[model samples]
Target chain A: MREQSRGPAFMRILYLEDNPLLAFHVEQMIEDLGYVSAGSLSSFAELKEKFQSLQFDAVLVDIDLVDGPTGPDAAAWLQKRGIPAIFVTGQAQVAARHHDISLGFIEKPISPSDFAEKVELFRSRSTGS
Target chain B: MPIVILLDRASKPELVRAELARSWPRARLIFYQRPVTAVELVSGVQSALLVRLRQRDVRDHIGQEMELRRELNHRVKNILASVTSIFEMTRRGATSLDAFTDDFRGRLRALEKVHSAVFHAAEGAVSIGDIATLTFEPYRLVGQERISFSGPLMNLGRESGTTLALCLHELTTNAIKYGALSQPEGRVTLRWSVIDGVQPELALEWKESEGPLVIEPARAGYGTRYVRSALAAVFGRLPTIAFEPDGLRCSAQGPLSRLSATDSSQPR
Candidate 1:
C-alpha cells in the first residue's frame, strides 16, 4: 500500500439492489462507514438513467434486482465504464463465478467490520494502493 | 379602466391591497378608516374570501398527493426487503450451479405469482383455494389430475397468501424431487378446512404418496427452512413435515381471521 494518510477521502457509492428496504438499510451503513450513498435503483435501466449524473466512486450490487438476475451484467457494465463494483450478496458462491467483474464481495446481512474492511479494499483498489 | 376600490383600514386591508397592486397595477386603491360605501367594503371582503378558499384547496391537494407518494415509498421498501430476505435465505440449500439458479428463480416467480393473485382480488385479500389453483396451474397444464386440491373459498390476506404460496412452492418442489411427484404413479392431496367460531382458524395439510420410497434427508434445506421460517411469522405456528414410508406429510393450523383481509389501500 502507498503512503496511507487521511488521504482515503470519502467518496460516493451507487447501490444496485432490487429491494428498496435493503437499499435504505444499507444506505445508512454506507454513510456510517464514511461514504456517501449516491443513490439506489432497482433495475439496470434505472441505473443507466442515473449513472451519468451521479459521479459515484464505486458500486455495491445484488445478484437479483427488479429486472431479474441482471446484477452480473450491471457489474460488467460498470467495469467497462472504469467504475469499480463489489457484489454485496447473500449468494457469495454465485457471485464468485463473476469474480473478474468486480473488485471483491461483501456478504449480506452485512457485519460492520466486514463492510469496513471490504470498503477499505475498494478504497485501496480505486486509489491504486 | 382602473377599478378603484377603497378599503377599511381595520378590515385586513394590507393583504388585498398588495395583491390588487400586483395583479392590477393601473387600478387606483386607497385604504381609509371607513369605506366610503358598504358596497366597496363588502366587495373587498368577498374577494379576500375567494382567495382564502383557493389557497386552502391548493394546500389540501398538495398535502394529499404528498401523502400518496409517501405510502407508495413505504410499500416499495417493504417488498424490496422481503425479496432480499427470500434471496438471502434461499441460497442456503442450493447444491449444483443449476440447482441454485433454478431454485432462486422459482421462488421469485412464486412471489410474483402471489403478487398478481393479490392484485386481481377485489379486496387486498385472496381465496386460499385460488392460491392453490394458481400454484398448481403449471402442473395442471402438464396434466392437472395427479394433484388434488380441495378447499372451500376462505379469504386470505395478501401477506399471508404470499407466505402460503412460498410454502406451497417448497412443498411442490420437494414433491417433484423426492415425494409423490417424482414417480408417474405419485400423487398429492392438498386440503384445508375452516373451523368457524368467534375466532376462526384454518387447518391445512399437504399429503404425498405412491412415489419412490420416502427417505428423509440427513439435513433440512432451503425449501424446508423457508416453510418453517415464513410460517412462524405468517401463521404463528410451526408446521410438521414427516418422512413417512409412503411420502411426505406436512400440516399446520392457525387463526383464520388474520388471513381474511378487507384492506383496499393497494395501488393498482
Candidate 2:
C-alpha cells in the first residue's frame, strides 16, 4: 500500500465528459477536492490515447458521450487496463448495467459535496487505506 | 336504368310476372319460385338485371379498393414529408461533432416514437394519451421523478396525432437540454382539456418549474421555428409560448372537428 497522508491525497484522475458546461463544473469540483486531473477527454479516441500513455489512479466517465459508443465503453477499456472507474450518468439503467465493474455512479448535475465525498472514497481505496 | 330485384316466398309468381309484363311493355319480366336456382336463372337470361347487379357489385368493390389504396399512399407521403423536415432541421442546425450526434439521435427517436404510436393505434385515429405516453417515455427514464401528466382520454385523427407527437418530442428535448429535466429539483406538468361545443377545440399546457432561471433566447432557435411552423400548418393557428418568471410554458390549441373516426360524428 502507498503511504497514507492526512491532507488531500495525490492521485491522478482522467475525466470523460462531452458537455462543456457540465464538464467545466465537474473539473472545478475535482480541483476543489485537492485531486489532480491528469487529463479530461471528450471523445473515445482521446480517452484511449490518454489512458495508454499515462497512469491514472481512477477515471470519471459520463455514459452518454456524444461521439463515443457510451460511458460503459470507456469503462470497459479502463477495466481491461486494471484501472478503477466510476460512471457519472443521467441514465439509471446504464449505470445498473456496469454495476459489476464500476466503483459507483454519480448522477448528472453532480453536487459539489457529493463529488468531494466520492473523490475521497476513491483516493482512500486507491492507496489501499 | 336502375332496377330493383326482390327475393321473397309465399307469393304468386305467375300473377306477378303477368302484371309486370302488362305494366311495362318495353321491360322484360322473369319469374322464379321459392329456393330459386341462381345459376340456372343467370344462364337463362344473359342480359338479366341480376347479372347487371353482379357486375355493379364487382365495380363497386374495385372502386372502394382504389380509394383505399389512394388514401394509404397519401398517408405514407405525409409521413415521409414530416421525416424529411426533421432531418433537414437537424442537418442545418448541427454545429459540433457532439451536437451533430445528439441532435440526429434525438430527431430519429422522435420519428420512431411517432411511428410506434401510429402503429399501435392501427394506423387509424390515435388518442392524446398515446401521443403523450410515447413521447414522454424516453425523458421519464432520465428524469423519472420530475415529470407528471394529466389529461382526459381523448382521440385524435392520424394527422393530428402525428403533428401533436412531433410537438411533444420537441418540448421534451428542450426540457431535457435547457428546462425542467436539466435539474434534479425541477418538475414538469402536462395537462389538456377541450372547449367550444360546436367546433370543439383542444388545449394542451406544458408547465415547468424549480429549474435554473430561464432567459428568453434573443432569437428563436431551429426547434422553436419548427414547432411554430409545423403546428401552424396542422392547426391553422399559432401556438402560444411564454417564458414566465418561474419557468417556460407553452399552450397549443386546435379544432377537433378535423379529426377522422369511423363513427360518432357529432359535429364537435
Candidate 3:
C-alpha cells in the first residue's frame, strides 16, 4: 500500500470526464489520496478555453466527452504544451492507440491504488526527475 | 429436332407453339399439357416458403443479438461506473465498517431494484408512479405507512427514469439518516405532476416533516450533489433542495418532453 502522504508536493490533477458522477467521485478520491484536484471539465472544448487559467501538475482524460471522442486530441494538445496527460477510460484499446501522446492509461472504475501509482508517473514526467 | 413444349392447362398451346416455332425454326412441335397435381405444387411452395422464413429468422436473430450486445456493453460500463462512485461516496460518509456495509448495500440494492424495474417494463419506459412505489417500497411497514407518494400518470424514458431513481435514492437515504424517516413520527411526502400547455412541464417535489429540527449541513455532500447534478442533466434545470426548520423540501420543474421516453428532443 502506498503511504497516505507524499511529502509537501501535492500533485494537482485535472480530469476530463463527461459523466458528472464519475467526475465528482474521482475528484473526491484524488483528494482522499492526498492530491490536489484542479477541477473537472466535461468536454475538450472547455479544457481548451479554461486551460491557461487552471493550475495543475497533470491531466487525466476520458475517451468520450460531451462534444465527442476528442480525448486523444486533448492529450496531444497537452503534450504540445509540455503537460503530461494520462487517460482514465473504459476504452483502453482506443487510449492505447494514442500511447505516444499520453503518459499511460488507467482503466476505468479506477481503484485508489492503481490511480495513485499511475498518477505518480505524471509527477516524474512533469519534474523530469 | 423434336421440340417439346409443356404448356399450363390454362394457356393456349397453339399460341405458345407459334411463339416457340418463331424463335426456333425447323422443329417438330410436340405439345404436352402441364400436369395439375395440387398437392405436389402446394407442398413444393410450402417448403420454399419455409426455407425463406428460416433464413429471415436467422438473419433477424443475428441482427438483434448484435444490437443487444452493444446495449449490454454500454449498460454494464455505466453501471460499473455508478457502483464505483457509490462505493467511494459511502466510504467517505461511513464512520464504521458496519455503517459502510449498510449504507453501501442499501444504495446498491436501490440501484439494482430500480434498474430491474426499468428493464422489465414492457414498454421500455417506467411511469413516475411505479418509480415512486418501487423506490419507497423497502422502507414501508406492513400496516403503518410513514412515506406516501402521489403523482399523475407520467412516464419517463430509461435515462430519465434512472436519473430520477438515483436522485430519489439520495433523498430517501438522507431522510432515513437525518430527516423525516429517522424517527417514528417523521413522515415523507413525494408529489409530482405535469401541466399541459404548448410546452408541457413536469413538477416534482419531496417534503419531509414532523422530524428532528432540520439543520442544513455546512457543505453539500454526495447525496445533495448527486441529486442536483443528475436532475439537472435529465431535466435541463437544477432542483432546489432547501433544509427548512420544519423539514427538508426538494422541488424541480422542467419541460415534460425531456423526461418522457418517447420524445427526447429538447424544447426550443
Candidate 4:
C-alpha cells in the first residue's frame, strides 16, 4: 500500500458538483491523485461557506448546479478571493466563455482519466516548484 | 420634377420684393441659406445633392426589404415542399398501421423539435442539452423507469442539433421496440467526445445487457431502414452499424461544417 502523506503534501481540492454519483466519482479520482478532497459541496451556499473556511489549493466547479446559481458565479466569487478555479462543465458553450478568466476547462461526464490529468495540471501551477 | 426652393441673404431681397405667396403656391420648395463666396456656393450644391442621394438611399432600402421578404417566402415554401415530399414517400413505403403511425409521428416530431430549437437558438447554435432533452422527452415519458442518460454537456450547431436529435430519437425508438428499453432491466449509455487534435465526432453507445438475449432479426424491417435512412439524410453520408451479441452499436462520422450549416435552404 502507498503510504498516505499526513498534511499539505497532497494537494487540497474543493470540488462543487450537483450529481451525487458524479460527485462521488470525482472525489474518488481526487483521492487517487494523492490529494485530499478538502470537501465537496453541491450547492452554491455550501460551496461559498466551505471556501471561506478551508484553504483549498484549487477548485473544480460544474457549470449547471442543481440549485439556482451557476458555476461561473461561484468561480467569480473565488476569483474575488484570489483563489484559482477551473470549470468542469459538459456544455462547450459555457466553457468557451471561461477562455479569459479560468485556469482551464474540463468537459463533463467527468471521465476519470481527464479528471486526473486536469487535477495534475492545476497542482503543477499552484505549486510552481 | 421635385421643385427646389432657396432662402438666403441674396434671395431675401427677391423674396421680400416679389409676390412670395403666389410664386410658391403650387411649387415644392427646398430652402437653403445663401453662400457668401464661390466656395460656399459649391459646398451648398454638394449638400443639396447629398440630400437627393439620401432620398434615393431610402428608396433602395424599401426595394431591398421587398426582395428579402420574397426570398424568405420562397425558402419557407421550399421547406414545406420537402417536408410534404418526405411524408408522401414515408406513407407510400409504410405497410401497416403501426409502422405508418410510428414513422409519421416520429418524423413530424423530429422536424417540429428541430424547428423549435432553431427558433430559440440565437446564433444558429443550440445547446446539446436542449437537443437531448427535446428529442428524449417522449422516450423519457414512455419509458420513465428504464432509460437514463449520462454525458458531458455539449452544444451543437442549431442545424446539427436537429440532425443529432433526430438520430437519437430514431435510436431510442429502435431500442424501445426491439432492444434495451423493450425490457425492464436494460439501459443505454449515451456519451460524446470532442478531441482537440482530431475531428470532433459524437459517439453514442446503446448497450443492452442483463436483459433478454437479443437475436439478430432474420431481415431488416422498415423501422431499421427508416432509422438508417434518416441518419444518413442528416449527415449526408452513410452510417456504420455493428450487430453485437449484446446490443446494436452504430457510429456516424462526418465533417462538423456540414453538420453546422444553419441555412434553411439545406434540406432537413
Candidate 5:
C-alpha cells in the first residue's frame, strides 16, 4: 500500500507487463505521450514487493502476467490503497468481471489513440477538476 | 385402463397380482413371466446405456474443441500484440526506413521460426536447443560455424519458448552488428546445464569471444533490456549481463520446475 504520493508533478505511469517487448514499447509510448515511466514489473508479487519505492500516478495492468491471472486481484489491492489501475489485456471478458476495481479496460493490439484516451481518464479522475 | 405386469421367473406372482389389484381396482391386468433368455434383455439395456455414453462422449469432445479454439484465439491475439509492440519499438529506434524494415523483418522471422517449431512440436512446446538452432541457423555463415549451443533435453511451454526465441533474436542481431558475429574469426558459445538439488535449477550462459574489444554501452538498448525483462519473466529471476573487455557474457539460473513445459505453471 502506498502512503502518499512521492511522485513528481508530471504523471508517472507504471506497467505491469510480462512481455518484455511490449513493456518496452509501452514505456516508450508513455514518454512519447509526455509522461514519465515509473518502471515495469513482470508479476503481481513483484508489484507487491516494489510498490513502496515506485512512484507512479497510475498503473496499466495485463491479465496474464509472469504470475498467473492475478491482474484483477492486483487492481483490487491497488484500489484499496487508493491507487488507480486500468487493465490492458486481450481477455476482455475476464476483465469485464472485475470492472468494479479497475478504472476501465484497454483491449490488446493497443491503438495509440485509444491508449491516449483511456490513459487520460486517470489524469482527470486524479485531478478531480 | 390396460395394465401389464412383468415378474421374474422366481418371483411369487400372487403377491404382485394382489398388490396391483389393490392399487388399480378397475384396471384389466395382464401378467407375463420373465423371459428365459435374459441375455437379450440385458444386452438391449446395455446398448441403450452405451448410446447415452456415446452421446456424452461427443458432447465432451465438442466442449474440449471449443476450449482449444478459445485458447488458440487468445494465443493469436497475444502474438499480434507482441508484433505491434515490436513495430512501435523498432520504428522509435530506426534512423531510416531501411534500418527499420531490416530490423523489423528480422524480428518477425525470428517469431515465425519459433511459432513453426512450436506448431510442429508434439505437445505445442519447444526445447531450448531447438530455439537456439532455429534462431542462429539463418545467421550462420555458409561455410563457417560461428554460433554453437548445447543443453539438456528440457522443454519450455509455448509462452516461455516464444519469449526466449525473441531474446535470442535480439542477441543474434546485436552479435551480427557489433559483437562476436561481426568478425569472421569471432565465436559465440551458448551452454546450459541442470543443477540437481532439492529444487533442480536450469543454468545457462551465453559468451562471445575472439571479436573486437568489448565496451559496455553508456545506456542499455532495446536488445539488452528486452533480454533482461524477458528472461526474468520466464525464470522468475533476473539474468546478469556483463561486457568484459574480451567479450560479452549473459548468464541466468532458475528453478527447473518453472522452466519445464510439463509442469503446471505456478505463480511465484
Candidate 6:
C-alpha cells in the first residue's frame, strides 16, 4: 500500500489472471486508467515464487485461476505481505467469502466507472493515513 | 357366493369340492362333475378372469410408460442445465457480437456431438477415446496424419463426458488457430494412461510439434481458460500448460473416482 505513497507514487498493479486474453484486456484497461501493470501470473504457485520481485502497489485477483480456486489464498497472501488486494472475478459469492481480506471487488466485464471508482478508493485508502 | 371349482372328467366332483373348500375356507366350493369345452369355458366365469388379467396388463403398461416419461423429463432437464452453463461461460470471453455467436454455437455443437456419442454408446458411460475422435474429426478430414490421439478404454460419466468433450473442443480450436495443427507439417499427439497408487489417476498429455516455434503469449486465451476451469471442475485438479520454444505441451491428472463407476477406467 505504501509503494504508491512514495515519490511519484505510480499505482502499479499486479494482476492474478489465468486467461491470457482477459489478462491482456484487463492490463490494457489498467494502463488506460493511468495505472502501471506490474505483471500478470496464472496461478498461486507462480505468485508464491515471484511476488517479491514484482513491483506493484496492489494486486487484482480473480476468484478462480489456472491452479484451481486459489484466488482467496492469493488475497490472503497479499494481506500477509502488507499489501492491499482487490478481487476482480465473476464468482461473487466465492469472492465474498474472502472479502474481508481484500479491500473490495470489481465484477467481470468490468464497468469502466466501477474500475475507476475502485482504483480511486484504493488510492484514497493509502493517502488517508 | 359359491366359488365353483370345475373338475375334469377324470376327477370325482365330491372329492375336488372338499379339497377346494378346505383350501379356500371362506368360500363355498361347488365342483362341476363334467369337463367343459373351450367354447363353454370362454362363455363361463373364466371370461371374467380373462378380463381382470387384461385390465392388470393395461395397468402395468401404463405404469411403465409413466416411468419412461419421468426419466425422459429428467434427462431433458440435465441437458438444458448443461447447455445453459456452457453458453453462460463461453459468453464471458467472446470479444464481439460475431465472435460470441460463433463461439457459443461451436460450443453448443460440441455438446450436441458428445450427446450423440453418448446416445449411441452401448454402456452407461462413453469412452474418452471416442470424445477425442469427435473433437478432432474436422482436422482429421483435412489430413489423417496431422492429428492423432491414443488413450486407454476409459469410460466417463455423462457430466464428466460433457466436460471432457468441451475441453477437447477448446484444445482443438487452439491447435487449429496457433498451435501445431496450424500448418501442413504440424502434428499433435494426445495420449493418456492411468497411474496406479493408493488411488488410480487418469493422466492426459497433449503435445504438439513440427510447426512454427511456440512462445508463451502475454496473456492466456479463451481456450486455455475453458480447459482449466472445465478440467478443475470435473477432475478437481488444474492442467499444466507449458509453451515450449518448439511447441505447446499440456498435462493433467486426477483420480478415476470422478468419472468411472469403479477402477475399470484403467486399461486391463
- The candidate maximizing DockQ is 5
Chain B TM-score of all predictions, in order?
0.82, 0.71, 0.74, 0.71, 0.76, 0.70
Where does candidate 5 clash, by residue pair? Answer: none
lDDT of 6 at B94: 74
lDDT tens readout by residue for model 1, B1-268:
2244565556677788788889888644545446366786677666666666777899999998887895576466556656666665555456777988888888788888989999888776888888998888766744359889898888887767877887888889888876789788889999999888898888898999888888888987767655654564455455787889998888888777545643333433
DockQ scores of the candidates = 0.05, 0.01, 0.21, 0.01, 0.44, 0.03
Better of 1 and 4 by TM-score: 1
- TM-scores for all candidates: the values are 0.60, 0.51, 0.65, 0.51, 0.77, 0.53
Q: Give the 10-residue window scoring lowest on summed lDDT in candidate 3 chain B.
A: B259-268
Name the runs in model 1 displaced over 4 angstroms.
A1-129, B1-43, B141-143, B261-268
RMSD of each: 14.1, 22.9, 10.4, 18.3, 7.3, 14.1
Candidate 4, residues A41-116, lDDT tens digits: the string is 6556666654556777778887655344367888888887776788876565777787566788886545556667
| Residue-level lDDT tens digits of model 5 in A19-128 | 77688788777777777887688778888987888888789999987667788888888888988999999998988888899989899999999999888888777766
The residue pairs that clash in candidate 6, if any, are A20-B219, A20-B220, A21-B220
User: What fraction of the real A-B contacts shows up in model 4?
Assistant: 0.00
**Local distance difference test values of all predictions, in order:** 0.74, 0.68, 0.79, 0.63, 0.82, 0.73
lDDT of 6 by residue, B209-247 (tens): 987889788887768866765675456566788898788
Docking class of 6: incorrect
Best candidate according to TM-score: 5
What interface Cα RMSD is found for model 5?
A: 2.8
Off by over 4 Å in 2: A1-129, B1-43, B46-58, B196-199, B258-268
- Identify the CAPRI category of the predicted complex in candidate 3: incorrect
TM-score of 1: 0.60
Q: Is the docking of candidate 5 incorrect, acceptable, medium or high quality?
A: acceptable
lDDT of candidate 3 over B59-158, digit per residue (tens): 9999988867765675578679889888888888778999899888888888888789887986668988888888888777621488888988888977
For candidate 2 chain B, the 10 contiguous residues with the lowest summed lDDT are B259-268
